[model samples]
Target: MAKQKTAFVCSDCGSDYVKWQGQCGDCHAWNTLKEIRLGPAKGSGRAGASVADQRKGFAGALDSARVLKEIDLDAVPRISSGAGEFDRVLGGGLVSGSAILIGGNPGAGKSTLLLQTMCHLAKSMDALYVTGEESLQQIAMRAKRLGLPTDALRLMAETNVEAIVAAVDELKPRVLVIDSIQVVHTDELTSAPGSVSQVRECAAYLIRYAKQSGTVLLLVGHVTKDGSLAGPKVLEHMIDCSILLEGSEDARFRILRGQKNRFGAVNELGVFAMTEQGMREVKNPSAIFLDRGSEPASGSAVMVVWEGTRPLLVEVQALVDDSQLGNPRRVAVGLEQNRLAMLLAILHRHGGLQVGDQDVFANVVGGVKVLETSADLALLLAIVSSFRDRVLPTDLVVFGEVGLSGEIRPVPNGQERLSEAVKHGFKWAIVPKGNAPRADIKGMRVTAVAKLSEALAALE
Candidate 1:
């Protein structure tokens, strides 16, 4: 008979403990320890578990199990999901037998993305979509509303894990997508569906089955109230990649970011606009960002921001005004708030700008937010130029990270930034004094300034 013992395990990090305590020693999370069935009781401490007794069940099976070395890897070619942005996030389309985990907020269009992907993949290959949270009729209705083709795409409405895996084996589908993993459960675990144990086990089994059968699996996961994977943390580790979807509450534009990817670039971001025609990819994003009819005004500057290998030109707008309130308010949207505050302080102290009694609001024109620090200098210049009531030259482009001492700092890939500016027909680029590349671009001149004082002087 197998011996049973008691042990304490952390509910969060899976750390083990000898004694039950209110606080976990490893992760410092409170009340995370729960009693678990352990191995041997007393003398099994030093060697962890006695190998003498360890020679037991599954040993014969383990010795005989052999891994496949000549599996067919190129049997199924990747099916491109129509959208370029979506394809980039997926690392050059879907792999043959890869498993993907997608999570996001409610109504954030997790279903929309996969549904569209299925429709696109169905054009070339047979794709199966299994949904635990919705019925086949409901899925069909949504597909019709989204104008997606349904002839090649198959839909299965089942929640039982056994039945799901059996269907996949029989169908030999090219790609399998699970709408949400939280609702699927197996009979082996006593815990209910969506519980930590059930989720982890379900994901593990599905991943193993996908790998063995050579079916690309896409698992749609739910996010918790705290914006984390709804189930245990280990659920993320069992899969090959994770994609995160972020959107505003009002739903004007949505951002797709790669949280983890083993196949492609990590810095790539996909931009999509929510429209009546459906989620359309904005290929030329900069054109959509510029103001259409507004006159060229003071405090607004055009600068180039790099997103991965692509250079995106944006219009940075700032409104600086005198304040009647004792504490002047400074607000920033689509950029770092603390960094804006720091830039304002530096402008006041070193650049001799009177911003303390000014009410300022800065915006990145479009709904897209800036993540790269290279936009810092452009933003700072826009705010200063706006406060001084000076209209920046339309042919000028500025980008750099500013230091606390009011010095313009160099950012990565300066050459690419300049090349992009030159291609866009910008005659002048104000960059860091020493770091500007001497790379030649016809009809464009690069101006490198060392300090903000020098930049303000040149701009004026």
Candidate 2:
């Protein structure tokens, strides 16, 4: 037998260390190191039965490289999950043999979404949902409650990775849904399930099975306190797609975001509303984020933000108050706090707004997170409105990148933004001078401004 080696692994960031330490060297996390024993890998010259060496099924095949010209020109077809919103985030549909990792907070409905999709996928293909966390009867109850077609879908409640792989070979399923990789463990590994070693090893086995068998693997994952996918950081690189399902637990709305995709566009958003039945797709997402008030309100501005290829009209709201504390608080929800500070500085210096002593708060309505700078102008306008107690035009929409020097910079897809604003009955638009689209939008009147002072002046 080969000599067994022991190593310490950080549970928080999956960094391997030679010895025990109070703090992890890589993640700087304290008290996260755990000791684990490692045996020689499978297919080794000295092994009796290697951990993952048995390649009795499709994984045993090997192929040589072929010439580029010899490859067929046929296009691969994507399988639609019968859910438009899910398909939208997946760049049309799910590709065969692709491995997707989905992470979300507890009660974020990761299981519900996958269960619904698997039911839909079972209509045409052989779909199997293996649950390591929940019982088969519990899944059946959920399927009944969600009004899903359960007859076509198969369910298995097993946590053993070796058993799961053996079942995959016996079933030969095209679509495989693993409730979570964290709970599944291999008997060969002495560490408990959800350990870093267990997660990496189990995921590797499943990924190899999916790639060799041409099966689409959907993995449900847990999120850390920082909202990143749990387990080793390399787990994200091994999969073809990485997704996050996020929203407030109290709110009925949920946002499915694609953080990484090899076959599709990254940072794509899909909107869904929770109901008694199940998750329903939101077709007109612009209406969900925009406030439809007849009269204009102070500290509120409209912004046309691009999510993937779709344009969404979202409301930017800000509140300014006199602070009694030594350092005024700058709080932002759904918007970056650092960006708010920079915008406030620009407003005070260039636009001549007195906001240094006031406490500022900014928010993007309807639980939609805005990460781009295209909504900077609208956010600043909302801050100014709250500070000066002024109400801007309700029908007007604004979008432009605000620089540190208070310059209004042009954003991408200017025409799409303007057209979306017009489609939603907006009469006025304040855009960057450089972003004046070539084609004119009929209903909305566009005013191009180059400087921050010009944009503030137009609010009068």
Candidate 3:
């Protein structure tokens, strides 16, 4: 007989501890340690029984490896779903035998996007959608409401992992979509579905099946409150690609960002707009993110930021007001709080703006998040414009990284940013001194500044 033991596991990092604690030692997440009862050790009498049950639907055998030169390069061709933005994020199209994990907040349109993709792909290739969360009738209703044809598509509503795998083996679909990996369970595991062990094991079986059968597998996952994919962190590492569908709940715009991709580039983003028909690709995101034909208002500035291979012009807005409370508040949306604080300090020390005692709030328009430092200068300028109550030129676009000593640092792809700005009818641009255009951009003027003070003076 094997001895059973209790272990405390951190939900964020999957690190197991001997005792329960308030904070996870590895991930530093507070109140995340959950106590779980472990079964007997591996290799015990029950081990073989559980392992054999879990391996029932998994494909068997491993082929011998071949030399790099002898391997065929064109065995697998990428499959296109006819969605431009979606294909762009995938680095062309979906690859055979590749496992993709996409997670997002509830109602962020994960199911809607996947269903649309399945509908499109079903027209050309054999596509199967297995929904554990919703029934076939519900899915059909949604498809009908979205005006999608369900003739070529096959839908199965099953939550048992083993049954789903059996169906996949029998059907042999070119593309398979699991509505959510969290809702599926296997009888081999005593733990419930969505548990760390069950999620990890179930995904392993499905991924193995995909590899052996050359089927493209798309796994939809749930996300935690912190906007990270739920389940064990190992779940992310087990897949070929990890994608995040990001957008505000009330906003129509959705950003499909690739966090990890084995066959393509990482950090690539595809912009989409949720419409009455379905999710529509935004070919020109600049026009959506930037407000045009309005008078230039205080605390508003245009910034040219790069998302993957594309450059977008978005408006950054800030507000500075007298603090009625004892401690002044620093609020930021679509921008990091720490980053905003650092920029405010640089503004006061370098740009000679006093705003520490006042309440500061900043946001990026169109529900877009600014993660890069290229928007630092524009954010500072917006805050400065609000503090001074001065209106900046509506046609001006600014982009550069602001350093601790108030130096404006050059950003990558300076020429591309300027070109994008010019295309959007921006007449003037403020860039880092060293970031001169490789070629002259037509219909635009470039004013390079090395210091934050120079950038602020350019507003005069």
Candidate 4:
């Protein structure tokens, strides 16, 4: 019998070391290394020859090296995920022999979404749904409660990766879902389930099987407190696409954003609303996000922001009040805090609006995060409107990137943004001079600004 080997693996970065240490050399994280025991050496009688041979060429394909130009350019067909919003985030649809990782916080409906999708997809293709965290009865009950078609989808409650692969080999399903990678374990490693070693090995074995079988693999993952996937950082790199399901428990809306994608565009957003009938796709997300009151208040402004290939019109709100603390509070929700401070400085220096002694609060309505710089002009204008107790026109829209020297910079997809705003009945727009349309846009009045002072004057 071969002696059991042991190694220390970093829980944070998944770097392995021969011996234990206080800090991980790779991630530089303190006290993250944990000991993991290997079962045995391959082909050493303990692991057996069959297991060793299987790992030799897990992909099950061997070909001679060829020139890049000789490679086939035929597009691979995509499998529809049954949900339009879900399919939108996945480029067009799910790709065969591809691994997709979806992570979310607990009770964020990771299992619910997969169950809903699998039930619909099983009607057309051979699909298997494996549950490591829930029982078979529980899944069936939920499906029935959601009024889903329960006759077609195959269900299995298994945690062992080897057993799952064995079942997959016999069933030959077109789609396979593991809910989730954290609970699955492999027989080759002695580490507990959800450990770094267990997750790494189990995902590798399953992914290899999926690739060899030309099956679509969907893995549900858990997120850390900070909303990032909880696993070895390399786990993200191993998958073809990585998506995050974000929403609080109290909120009915959930946002699925693609953090990584090989088949589709990154940063693609999919909106869904939770209801009694499972997850319902929000086709016109812009409408739901822009549902405002009849009366437009001061400090409230509308902005056209680009999301992936489409344009989104969201509201930007600001509040400027007297500060009780010695250091004035600068708070921003769903927007960068540091950027708000910088924009305030520019407003004071160029726009001649001073709010340094007052507390400034900024928020993007509808829980949509504004990462693009196009919200710079809108945010600054919202703050100024709040300080002056002025109400901007409800039909007006704003978008531009503000530079340090107070110059308004043009943003990408300016034409698309204007068109979307026009569709929503916005009759006026404040944009950078570079983004101004050469031709008239019919009913929309375009106000082009080159500097911060010019933008401030437009508000008057």
Compare the candidates by TM-score and give the number of the best one: 4
Which model scores highest in lDDT? 4
Q: Candidate 3 clashing pairs?
A: none
What is the C-alpha lDDT profile of model 2 across 304-412, one tens digit per residue?
Answer: 9988878889998999999999999999999988888888889989999988789999989998899999999999999989998999888899999998888999999
* Ordered list by TM-score, greatest first: 4, 2, 3, 1
Model 1, 232-271: lDDT tens digits are: 6666666777988878568777777777777777656788
lDDT of each: 0.78, 0.87, 0.87, 0.89
What's model 3's lDDT at 390? Answer: 92
| 10-53 per-residue lDDT for model 4 (tens digits) | 87777888999998888799988877776542223443466544
Residue-wise C-alpha lDDT for candidate 3, range 306-327, written one tens digit per residue: 8877788999999999999898
Poorest 10 consecutive residues by lDDT, candidate 3? 39-48
The regions of model 4 sitting more than 4 angstroms off are 1-9, 14-21, 24-28, 35-60, 73-75
lDDT score of residue 242 within candidate 2 = 92
**lDDT agreement of model 3 with the native:** 0.87
TM-score of each prediction: 0.82, 0.92, 0.91, 0.93
Q: Return the lDDT, model 4, position 133.
A: 91
Global Cα RMSD, each model? 6.1, 2.9, 3.5, 2.5
